[model samples]
Target: MSKRDLTDKGTISRKYAKKEILKTIIGYLVFYASWMIVTFWLLYFFEEIPHFDWILWILFYAVVIPFIVVLVSVTWYSYRYVKMFSFEVLESDIIIQHGVFNR
Candidate 1:
């Protein structure tokens, strides 16, 4: 596609693209750090309790699985958001488009 066509279709602004990339990186880093800390804390806590295997298993399914699901969802959503949403600064006005179907 031509540059004009791409811009008109809201392919994205360079500034916004960089910002979004940075945001995604920072979010993942924070998520991983928090997950590690929480995992260690839970392991230590469960170790203190007698016969906590069941509780550990329960927590694995309830907390860990959901946490993983949420992380995956957020990553996928962010990727979609970045791909689908874009801004174009025209001389007359700013143009924004979101969603592959609509565009």
Candidate 2:
């Protein structure tokens, strides 16, 4: 089968699939690692405060949960968008198929 034929059958192009998976993993790891580093830095900087442990826990959850949720949502949306919008390497164009009728 042709490359285009494979993509049309809902099979991701191998090259694009590998690239997307790597990008997704790296994106997630970088985001979470940065958050962790910042959290620890803040905790250390504010060590003088009383009940800092409790405060840190509260702040960490308050900030990290929403951040994680938003990041995950955006990531998922990106993957879905990429999957739906087929890419043609030779033509250098993306075919974005939308709506139930189109499918």
Best by lDDT: 1
lDDT per residue as tens, model 2, 1-103:
2455433324344465457656766776787678767867886798844476776776577656765776677667656755565433333444434412233
Where does candidate 1 clash, by residue pair?
Answer: none
Q: Give TM-scores for every candidate, taking all chains together and pairing residue i with residue i.
A: 0.46, 0.39
Q: Candidate 2: lDDT of 63?
A: 56
lDDT of model 2 at position 37: 73
Local distance difference test, candidate 2: 0.58
| lDDT of candidates 1 onward, in order | 0.62, 0.58
Superposed Cα deviation of residue 24, candidate 1 (Å): 9.5
